[model samples]
Target: MGRKNISDQRRGEIIISFYEVSRSLGLENASIAKLAQHMGISKGLVLHYFKNREELLLGLNEYILEQHLRVMVSEDIGKMDCKEHVIHFIENLFTRAWNTYFDDGVFYSCYALVYRVPEFKESFKAYLIQLHEVLYKKLEEAVAFDVIVATDLKELTEVIFALIDGAYYYLGMYNEHDLAYKQQIAIYVKYSLRLLDFRS
Candidate 1:
């Protein structure tokens, strides 16, 4: 949104409205008018703060990343042993992504828009880089503590992340029960453990 000195509460409300509207109606169909309608406010109000749909989307994307980071940072991972940290990381990755349709839907929607909207590519890439950094650091810590043997930390992080991403996509596509979706997570976790030379 605009760099105007808006109240944090108000800005948060606007970001959530954008998220809800985009989730309900695909991002392609979400407009300032639609968001205003969803928020029970006037479009002029939204425009006054955001200036444009792109700005609103950018703000919402940042909000999404902030929310994810809060969840990750809130974890007491530092207190856990290397092996427990690895398990928690894997479990948190899958569970967090599967929590809601809006979360993943808006996520991939922003991802899709990155190709056509050049302005968004950097933000999306930065988000991915942050996630990669988190995973890479965790893997390095695991290797340092001899919890796992990974000759190439970067490559191992990519492999583990790719498996989770693939499983997350597949689970989102089906209407199966959450238990079934979690079974998919278990499978990915099993494969990741074996690949990382760690036994669960």
Candidate 2:
């Protein structure tokens, strides 16, 4: 049991190093040998954990999902009530907070793999579905607490994520300081609040 735990920890460490390297270098350039050097370990050791770049990317997809959860949802949202939670949730999704956790280039590179490999496609879908599930739960809570109206929670969750996906992809082209970036956030938030029937 102890050995299994250690193995999982080691595998997670290697995946994190892979994410960092992929951020600096392109994902295609982030090879296993490169990850080994980045960790100051050996290629053979890295291989022991990840058989190849394909498997390592599968691990990276999991890492991206974990980071997205941190950005999109929260446990108690740092003691915030449901209303504060809704606003923070919306603002965080549109802001640069994700930059602190994962790189856009590294993330999208992994996303592109969804088109190439079946297993990779499933992992990527898991990433999206995981986010959707958590957000749906949060929306349910907001309705329970009267923070939002009791509409079709599932449908509203889907619409919100669709808006979020579109906002991020388009806003990625603009600098965070650009007026266009701020405007997009405002525009999306306004409609999202309307959907939730948010008064504040």
Candidate 3:
């Protein structure tokens, strides 16, 4: 690999190790030393990639953003049409599938730092905007394809995201298999589709 690719790969490795350790141990207790120990690497090597805890936290936010963005585009979206894109999004939005991406505990932990860290706040803001754009673009395509009619695509996107954000935060507090959890997800999905006037 090239020098830059190797550097990027090394950063990724260190960040993933950081994430794993943070999940196993709370983010407050997830230190550079613990991450190095978990990865069986030297503390110096970890510092070589991230100079300090703040820098490491910034990198972790980048990693978190990458994983969260993956939820916007399914592997099958390329094969599906515009309408399928919208359906695929709605179907996956309220699911516990995000667990496969990143642990909610670790995610919220990083989020807490946003109040104190400017870089973390910017990175998080980017995540939110990117997420909105991804779905907004898809909804625009659906409108062009004559799949769904909407008066305001932007408003629709925000409304849907509001439901998702609210439902996600509420649902995270309960067991995924709980009846209230499942029922609330169903109710949100139903209303979200209804807002889009989506018959499917």
Candidate 4:
């Protein structure tokens, strides 16, 4: 039993190492040898947990998707008003999701690969669509409860998502201050609500 547990732990570590490498170097460049060197492990050891590069890339995508789901489906969304919730969500996203996964060059590499690489496009798009759906549902709930006065939930949700995405991208590329990111997102959210004539 102890041996089995150790093996499981090692396997988990290998997966995490692969994810880190992929996030930093892009899936195509995060080769097994490079990952092994980074993790201080042998190529055979990585192969023990994953059959090949494809398997490792797939596992990385799954791990990233799971993390995204956890952030998007946070319970905090259900507990706060639309304005507070949206602001809180955006703030948390920058502090948690952005800071955690994307504090280095690796994330940019992964982003470039995910969008430009035809093979990974489907997984990337699926993850984005899932995120959008979750946000849409949360925004729709806010509308139903009269927290936001938007008649078109879909459009409002897209606007919010786009605003947040744009803010994060800009912050990631040039600025690196949490305060500025939050301020920009807050302003966008307020402007969006006001444009929709949402009175709250």
Backbone clashes under 3 angstroms, per model: 0, 0, 0, 2
- lDDT of every predicted structure (CA atoms): 0.76, 0.85, 0.85, 0.68
For residues 1-200, could you state the per-residue lDDT of candidate 4 as single tens digits?
99999987887788788877766776557799999999998999889888887666666666676677787777765543666775565556544354554333544455566666676667677878888898777667666766766677677668867876776666665454557766765676566555444455
Q: For model 3, give the RMSD to the true fold.
A: 2.0
Across 76-187, the per-residue lDDT of candidate 1 in tens digits comes to 5563246777777776666654454347778888889888888788887788778778778877777777787757889988988888778778877755567777687778
The TM-scores, one per candidate, come to 0.80, 0.93, 0.92, 0.73
Candidate 3, residues 1-200, lDDT tens digits: the string is 69999999999999999999999998999999999999998999999988999999989988987887787777755522456666667879889888889999999999898899898899888888888998888787777666788569899889999999899999988898899888998898888888875534
Give a tens-digit lDDT track for model 2, residues 10-95. Answer: 99999999999999899999988889899999999999998888999999999988998987765536422468778877777777
Top-TM-score structure, candidate number: 2
Shift in Å, residue 37, candidate 4: 3.7
Residue ranges of candidate 3 with Cα displaced over 4 Å:
77-85
* Model 4's TM-score against the true structure: 0.73
> Which lDDT value does model 3 have at 104?
93
